[model samples]
Target chain A: MKKSDIIKLLILIIAVSLNVKTMKSMHANQAEINPDRAKISGKPVASFHKFWADVKWMMFIQHMGSIDLTTESNSKDLYQEAKDILDLDPGFYKVYELSALMLSAKTPDLAIDLLKRGQETHQNKNDWRLYSMAGNIRHQETFFNKKVNKREKLREAIGFYRLALKKPGVMPVLEKTYIKTRAQEAHEANNDVPLVIAELLEWDKYVNTKMAGSEYGMEGEGGDMFLSLEENTKKDILSLIQRVKREHQNNLAGKKTSKAMLASLFKGIHTCNSCYNEYGAGHKFCTDCSKPVKVYGICPNSQCRKTHSNGKFCEHCGTNVKPKKKKK
Target chain B: MDETFAIASSLWKRLLGVRVVYFLTICAVSLIAITNMYDILMIGESRALMVDTGMMLTTIAAMLTVISLAFDIPKELQSGIASVLLAKPLGRTHYLMGKLIGVSWVGIFITSLISIGFVVIYSMSHGAPPAGLVKALFLIVISVIPMASIVLFFSSFLNEAVAATISTVFIWVGYSLASLNGVTLFDLSLFSMGAEAFYNYEIPPSYLLKGVVSALLTAISIVCVTSFIFNKRDLQ
Candidate 1:
């Protein structure tokens, strides 16, 4: 090789060696992500905030586009990063809003707590726009979580909005309108009246009655919402309950929902190979994830020549059976 | 001005056949595929995730576009295209500005196409595009201007591989710096800041004014410096 070629080759070797060393250092640094030190608060400085943002971004990178129960553990690091950001700079409303939105699904309580912290800290900092966000998150949680104690969350939301209304510059109209809308939402989200009423009926069967000669009252639905009635009201309630039970018995006997009929309606339907979240028979795609559903009768591999959806796999080539995509 | 436009048109035409354009197009389509891979609405603020992911991908596309264009500059110099252009009455600054605008055009076009694809895929279920998606697209488009300019500046002195590498490092560093909460030097923040501010609805008039100014001034400054360097350099 010429002198120039030799020099170029040497430079390449040095560059490669340095890159390998850098890669090793990066790996070593990555291994230092100890969850134990996550709680250590940094000083309220620009560098501290950047460090926290980096930590949060790391967590987000690992668990991007997922906020299901599976991603909850990753949310812990995000939780710490959020705390660090807030502890360093309480007026960073964007971080609070982002954390609240992300953590609200898997860990609503943590999400709620973060927003509450934001509200108090931001109030101290004299920034009142957070009131809208705090209230909105509460409502959003209630809307998303099927098992949410709607009354409690709604009340907390209202409390935030009320405090926001008291903030010097907040318009009365907007606050009042937000409260009204949220209150209406609370009513709707209280698990539909019929669903709650059905639970109350189930409670009447299993609670407030003697069991095996024990005159003990059991905890009922609606928490402590029910109470002892007056004499006349008690008599009327007893009669109404007896009549409703009779009607329920009659309806139970009269209703005709055949298992075979249901099977017929559900014929050829299948569950999603992934998630299994919303099953439908004969579905071309997984109803939830929109991926082509694996089927018992057809090969999934596009290269497989087998055309039938038979047994577990294609008999000719043994490709896993999946639903065939309709040709456009 | 006409000459500059001619140079820009020629540069843009050349870029049409480059691998970066295809890479960015695939990146956009890959985003849709990735979105399809998940039940995207599974998260809190599903809409927010959609917007944020799309914006970040566009920024990445912008970065790669800048690198691609910057690398092209060195290749042009080696191939005598720079010398041939200089043989004309064209000023160095005008040539630099043309290259800047051409790369930006390519960058913004890729970003906007990808943004539109993301919007369509995300909003197809809802029958309408999500709120702030258009604004995010505009921010990404704006952010690419400075990114392309920075890469062009690097290309003025460095060879292809070095220009591409340095451009990527600088852009990433700028993005990281911009993401810092209290960083007063907003000029380096790029479009990521625009994405954050607009998506979060934290944008005041001052926020937008500052972001626009930062992007414009950075691009102009980088172009000026690149032109000065190109004029001073002795060509073979």
Candidate 2:
């Protein structure tokens, strides 16, 4: 045979061998029907049964895993199996996102790990939607952690809000706005009016200087600052401030209303400050009076309905009161 | 035109074919719709209902392609009627095109009617079809073009039974695998890895791959028809 024919024969052989190898590799990658694995894991080996079970477990995890972690929910097993199912079929990207979201409520660290795994496995691919979900989980974590520190809580809330805003997918602005307003309320409910007013002024200043050239214009430019305030119960804050100011003015006027309102305002402020110490942060004002109140001692005055701010005198009525000792 | 219509009517009468094909198509589609209903009830979740319907349509389309092409060509050849048919005003290409069109129309019509029935049942049980169902159905129909072309190509080359059955299964597997690859899966097991590599790395985008596959099948079908026209001597 000629040199050309020999080369052609060799090339054909190589081509056929490669094709056979490719075909073998294709079939070899499928999950084997391992009875032991199935028995231990309690997962079905059959494709249809496995697919059905995986989906069922995915739904179960979603519902149960979302409950408070402090509650003794039977979600641990569901979450574990859901992870296994994901490991079993990594192609099911929806399962990964759902599992992460669910797991975050119980074990935020595990949720973050799962999300990282998902990102690593399915990056810059069809499953990029999972990244946005992972970001949301991170945002929830930051929100939870913010409740730990009083002074840093607002800053942390802002960090979380900014992180969520930076994510690519279009999150509903209303939802974020609700979260931000709640954070602001929680902050105000903890601190005194001067602090809140200071924070608002600082935010206004930051917007003017830092966000001037950007899309987020000055306070009134895009109504960014005013929009945040719109959802807030301005009447509650305004009334509290007006009461405090009237008391201060009455202190100069030498009137009894000035003395009474000053004592009430001081008690209300003390209650809020004490509550922040107890509850950490994110406490709401009273549903009845819209005043920042705390659960401490009982009402001291016979006629007065409101509780005292851990004092011997009635802050509202100036009636000398007794501190009730605990029975235990 | 009258003569052509008369001949077409006569051909239909001579074949006694319409009823069997119609019955088979209905049975195929009904079986699919029933299975789909079972699937929906069993799953008990709101999924894209069109997915199951599309799968059934795919199977029906494949069956129609194989059965129609395999029988039509060999039956023409075996009866020594090819010469008589070619002797008429119609060319071999036109005859082949007409057969394909008629068979495809019958297949599509039956499948579509069954699909409508399935949709009605689904709506009654659930609600109106979701946003993407129509688009998905269009994709399934587009997929059948390649399936039919492949069957026609195989019919020209091979004997009826082997050609029809093999090509039917082959087309079903090929299309299913091709579409499955579009979805990402992360099982690093040998089987999944192989599938992923084949789908993600080896194959181009599904639309492009389907276009190429369909074009190739059409080209082969045309070649087969041309061969039949040139090679087969008249057995008068």
Candidate 3:
């Protein structure tokens, strides 16, 4: 061999050595992050790992079409097939979702396990559906899994909803379900009025934020839906406060506390002194309490006579509309 | 070096013009198109299915294009084409290097064409593919270098049939070892971004850098080894 060829060989040796070292480290790095690859025996080898996962997904869909979902044996078979598919490609999001949903019918615990596995997988950590669905399964397990403590399952479901709420882009329907579940839990287990009110307000804030961030002049029907939802939530808050105030009216200090809470929820609405029912602008009496109430912010001009919410001047006629202070 | 480039361009044109390469590419494109029909079957996962199938088909087509040279090399040598070419101003090392560069160029070009078709089809069915998928396709292009060099290494010393078989077996073993996490000198699986794309996981830039470096170094080393072996063999 020529001397030049000798030098080439030497360089090749060094290059190969470097490549082997890099590959070994690469393998080690992947091992650290790669969850244990599914170990199903006899799976055919393909050029790409995900390709087989795709094929298995097709087979799974075909099997899904043939099975009767209500049958216990069919559920078990479906779960096993899902497990195998997940073992090959743990990142298959729909597999985790559909399988967990179906498996929960017969095996709630296994469904939770699958969703929890999905949650642990890095790709799924931010996906809100898995967490919320897991919560739903746990919540319903009160009836399905007789061994579970009802209160404990409810608390677990609430906890899952909280996690789901933190993720961006949660569906409005899921939020509705979450709030209802929280209220039901509070009513049955704890009757913690303050906590329940706080959760309802949190949902209110989430809806408001979503509304605020929507594209200007482009919210379309979405804006109207949000507005309606906001209105309903505010009414709920008002009713809850009213119930508390009525319960506390016998004690002077408790009545004062309830009044303060009610004032915080509504900026300037007139409250009936006799029964604490809220009345609108220009109303002579509270609608529910049927007691005379003071009115404010009526336009001074008899011609305009518009009632403003709370302003020194009427918005319609620019006339000063502040109510005169009563002489003590 | 000019002679090397001359030989490379000529061989590249020859390989690119081969009917078999076009046939393989058409097969891949048609199969990828058929994968869209599997939409009803995949339930919400049809996008993932199509993406995985498109990438796999691209890899196979590109690899087959480069590996064709494994058979072509021995035929050229037996036909005394290498001898006639080496009789000129070209060095044996240049001849081998030229072939490697030419085959790798064809592999990358064909892979890119199919990838464009895939991205279009994928976009039509399911919005634009994630950036990770594009990166994954790019990795497949980078992979052709080492693959072409592996074929050259085997074809240098062995007959066409044996050379193609060993080259294929070596690549298959590399992928199998990857599944087992076994260390290898040239790990082809490092170039795969299929799982990342399927899961919509962002591949770290550091990993991408490492993969590109590893593939290039492996290709360079293998080509040098082939050159050494080819230099000692008698052309007659």
Candidate 4:
């Protein structure tokens, strides 16, 4: 062999060694950047870890597409798929979310566990959707399974929402959810309608403001699905607001409510003092109870008849307002 | 270096003109149609499934192009084509380097074409392909560098069939091999962005820069080793 070739071989050996060292350090750096690297276990077929995860995810979605979720049982296969997907790619946020939601129907504990795993391994620590879903699941579990403590589950769900609210870029729906759940807890413990209504109104105002600011915000549906929260969160809040308003209106009207309180709460609607039934304009009595109700807000002057304020005179026209005598 | 580049350019043009290249491109585009039809079946995950399938298909095509070098090199040597070229001013190292660049170019070309198809299909159905997907495709193209060099290195000593098999296996099992024994050499999974692309997460520019640099370094090192081996082998 030529002496030049011998020197070249020596240099090659040195170069390859140095290259190997550099690669090792590079691998270390990569590991540092990806801390959740430990989630992937077992020898993957063909090292297509991400590819196989995709295939698994496709299968999952395909199965989901095929089955009617209402009829389908929470089988062990679902849990296995969740484990397989999470194991294959811990960074798969959608897999965590959609699968956990599916699992939460019957296996809520597993769903919460999966969500917790997602929170730990997800790159974005500030992600609120996972926490929100976990809270939704937890809150739901209390209703279906009587075995669990209702108060404890409610507290945990509220805690999850609280944590979610602290994170940046949290959706307004979370705050609304937190309020609604807290109201539920309050109402369950004490049957306090006013306190729940007040909390619901606060959340409703916040969500409505957010909705007003965005072009995509949906106005609420009426009380068709009173059992379930609506898909459009703004709609859900609006629906809740309307429901609570009715409950509060009834509660306030049933009591010895001041005229100012009735005016502020009902806003242009008149209610019977005796029966708490609503009355139309020009009606001297409640239609339901036939009880005499003095419509005091109308101007007494025949020349300038208009709705008047609680003051002695009409605000729309300078005419004296008087309490008319009720019919015997 | 000029001769090497000239050889590379010619080989690139020649490979692009091949009938198989056209067939592969057609296959890749049609595969997109098949996945598009899978939209109803994938439920909410249609976009993700399409992206993953597209990336996997692109990787397979690029790897095939790279593996074809094994056959090309050995066939040239057996047919006295390499001898005729070596009889001139062309050095064996230059020849190998040219083949590496040329084959890698072909792989990259095919990958780019398929990527365009993927992006277009994805946009039509899913509004727009995410930025991360484009980055993933770019990384796959960059990874073909090391892959081409590995095939070249193996073909320098081993028979065409053995070289092709080993190269294919090495790339296929890259993630497992890396995790199994910390073997970073020839680990192709580093360039895989299948998950990131599917999730539509942003990939930092620094990561891409690192990938490009790493691919170049791996390619150069393997090429150096290949040249050394090829220099000692008797042409006859």
Candidate 5:
């Protein structure tokens, strides 16, 4: 070939190569850079995954340049970028909702993370909905990670359930009951016996009774019935109560040696059960009377709502109840 | 008077007749109308006013240069008018150079008028065009140099009507394709890749490579082919 023809061929080759290289670099960068992962593990896993994902996402953006996402050609990249965002902040609720709706199983972690993060930040009714969604994902993970000693994972899930309980707004009573029950199981498995028993009793008295006719009640189909806690924590609580009663009998019989033991027993049981039930069981019960608390009004369902010296039934809901008053 | 200047004056008078004025008026009106529409719709970025004005200058310059050059040599050849013009005391190169210079001057005038009108109207409707408007206008004017040469080369042999009409349409289409790197083809290939990857991993298209490469190729082709065609063609 002549020198001029060779030069022309070289130019064409160079142009094609450059275009290909540009596209390849973009793809490589997108794959490498993701948003920073929620530093779930140690520093190395957090930093390495985050750095790698971020670099990939940045390169993808650079490769894409200024594309309008509304166009059909640009929509794919837009969706991918959104997935990357969810990967970085899995607790980002909106991102999870969008990714789940759009990409589904391809970005399940993102969807779960989006809901988790939404629960963490907003603390609103919507945030509770997201929290419940995250709980569903955690439930699935719990089932899947059966072989993986998931103590820490369960703890994290418990945190989200607690957030859902604290969130303002009306939730389906069954859903709220379900969240409280799961939280009780998490606490019991983690060695919170008193909390486990207290939550069991609370659920027995309130949720189980209210849900008696519904699918959410302990007697209903798939009703947890606090069965999981009954098998483990109930035994523990019974032993503790027997020990406390024996120590108290010794104190009443003028055995001064067991007086301190009785006081310690009472304090330990009260502290353990209160902390465990309130924080771990996911119930916002009153500290004084140990009744379920309500927002915006004194508990109308409590016996304290009546004008009598010691009413036996709640004036509002007409149920047998105690009359002691307590503040949140 | 200098022979070059005298030749330029006569050529200018011939080219900028009533029809040329009408064409320029239509171009100016269209430009203002488009700018008004852009302003009313608010369909662009913060620098839109400046960019639009710059685009208007470039469009007018391109239209004037291509129309004038495509007609200059062809009209002279068709009317048996070259003999009368060639009998004058000017070299062939000088006559050609003078005609190009006159055309360029008219192009510059049209560009300036449209650019100024855009800025003034934009200022009245919105605020002043950005501070970079002048620099943008200068860049646009400089960019049209290759376009002017293209029409001039085509005019040397083709008839005025045919050269003007064909080259105008062709140059616009070529510029668009070259700038965007055959967007239609790129999108068609993307579709064949299947929907999942297309929706999840596709990158946005950029024109840095397409614009530079296509412009270079078109410029070289025009220069080489124009030289070859001009040298062999009868100048009747």
Candidate 6:
């Protein structure tokens, strides 16, 4: 045989020989290391949780292994996993973020518990994200939950938001005006009129959507009370939502033929005589023209001009006519 | 009958004659099996990485099988092996199918051995995986065909190395689609689906069916088109 062909043969033989050796080595190692075999020899693999010291590593491996896509409430594996992660090292805050968000959609209480534990454990760290998250949770639960006192939850949420603001570099103004008004002195110093109507309407939608379900069942003591509050709240909020939506359209049209456009869409649009722009039904100012808007038609006697009624009953002399109820 | 048998036998001989591919397969499976044995030390920790890594190793062995097909078929035609087969009573279509069948046997054998190694090692850590997980792996095995058919389809017109490269590229294209927002084509991603289902995510039946069925339909279409085209070609 030529030298090259002879060498090729040698290489092939050597490679096959090495492959066999490697397989043998692998088998020997498996015999020594296989969990089943080890169990027979009095060395069962230690249970999963015993390695709490390696919680970070454990969580990392567990998450790496599976991110359950199915949104099943029964799968509390993520919660247990998150708790373990926090228990071993309270600093794994990322776990709380993911775990809390996923858990909250199903179980708000556990979600709050996780965030609370995280907050207490990492208090020294002064993490604003934690405080912001806690506040948002309480705020959402105020609407989502009815078993709790709504006013107290709202107050707690406000407190959390305040704490978050005091933690340095917080911009409370970006979120909502109420927090901003409470937070900044300069906000009050300005001549800016607060957009209270718009804010109230949004809160109305928030309460309506959550309470539309049996948030806190109607069977208990405060359940009926909560339902009454929600009913009245919704009634007030719905009227506000309609009013704001109208004013919003009128402002966009500005002072130019806004009433004509508004009259085409809605029948009872309150137009500004000063600027031909429309306002909400119960407004006090021609918001566009800066003139007095609420020409109160609130009088019971027709002969008094001292209490001016726009066009309806006289505030000083005519009988007040309540709006007729629409048949459903 | 004698001529067809002779043709298939010749094709098998040429594939078996390539000592290097055989050695590579053995080496790949051994490496995966051994590394998995070592991961057993992690004990009660997630046995997922073992399955995930093994799935990757199986893909490597499948790739080697595919790359060999890229060169082997064209090299056979260039070296007058095709003429010898065509000289028989065997038709052009049978000759090509015989070659494909030979390639499939090699691919299935090597991939199966590698998959077994993965199962063995994973079993050592956490006993037998669920039947559904095994089913996903089997689907991965089936997904390999659509890719191999692509290489075969390309080999009908392109150079051997180029055919293999394009086939590998096609597999990667199916894979990268996973990063895009919605339909990640998990079932079509073959072994990746197994790795994800076993080690990463809970794959639902609807998703599995959609992916695997689409991939199988694709392979059947490609194989048919390539065979018909090859049958019509006039060899130089």
Candidate maximizing TM-score: 3
- Give the alpha carbon lDDT tens digit for every residue of A1-328 in model 2: 5464455456545544543443343333222312112122323231222334445554654555465553224446655666676544444455566667666676655665666566555322324345445545555655676654433434443443443333343243523343444445445665543333333333333334443444332133343333332223333333433444434433332233223433432344433331111221223564434567544454555588465665678687777667567799
Kindly list the per-residue Cα lDDT of model 3 for residues B1-236, writing each as its tens digit. 98888877987888877788777777788788778887677886667778888888888876787788898789899999889989998888888888888888888999998998888888887887888888889888878888889999999989999999998887766656666655588677777767766666666676777777888889889888888788879888
For each candidate in turn, give its C-alpha RMSD to the true structure in angstroms. Answer: 23.8, 16.3, 6.7, 8.1, 18.8, 21.2
Provide the lowest-lDDT 10-residue window in model 6 chain A. Answer: A40-49
Candidate 6 deviant stretches above 4 angstroms: A1-328, B1-46, B177-187, B190-192, B199-217
For residues A141-208, what per-residue lDDT tens digits would candidate 4 score against the true structure?
87898988887898899888776765665675566678778767766666555665645544544344
Q: After superposition, how far is residue A49 of candidate 5 from its true place, in Å?
A: 39
Clash pairs, model 6 backbone: A65-B199, A298-A315, A299-A314, A299-A315, A300-A317, A300-A318, A301-A317, A301-A318, A302-A317, A302-A318
Question: What are the Cα lDDT values of the candidates?
Answer: 0.56, 0.45, 0.75, 0.72, 0.45, 0.52
Positional deviation of residue A126's Cα in model 2 after best superposition, in angstroms: 15
Q: Fraction of reference contacts reproduced per prediction?
A: 0.00, 0.03, 0.51, 0.31, 0.00, 0.00
| Chain B TM-scores across candidates | 0.85, 0.63, 0.95, 0.95, 0.64, 0.76
Tens-place lDDT digits, model 5, residues B1-236: 36667776776676666486647655665655454554322323212333433354446455665477787778777786765766677645455555555665666656666667666765776676554354334333433444555676678778888888876765554334312333321111111111111112222233223323333343344444454555455655
For model 2, give the RMSD to the true fold.
16.3
lDDT of 1 by residue, B53-106 (tens): 566677677777778776778988899988899789987778888888888888
DockQ of 3: 0.46
TM-score of 2: 0.46
Which of candidates 4 and 5 is the stronger one according to DockQ? Answer: 4
Q: How do all models score by TM-score?
A: 0.47, 0.46, 0.79, 0.73, 0.37, 0.42
Model 5 CA deviation exceeding 4 Å by range: A1-328, B17-23, B26-34, B37-61, B180-236
Question: Candidate 3 residues A225-321, lDDT tens each?
Answer: 2323444555665665566556644545345545555565566566777766777788888888787889765777999977875677788988777
Deviation from native of the Cα of residue A135 in model 6, angstroms = 9.0
Determine the TM-score of chain B of model 3: 0.95
Highest DockQ: which candidate?
3
Better model by DockQ: candidate 1 vs candidate 2? 2
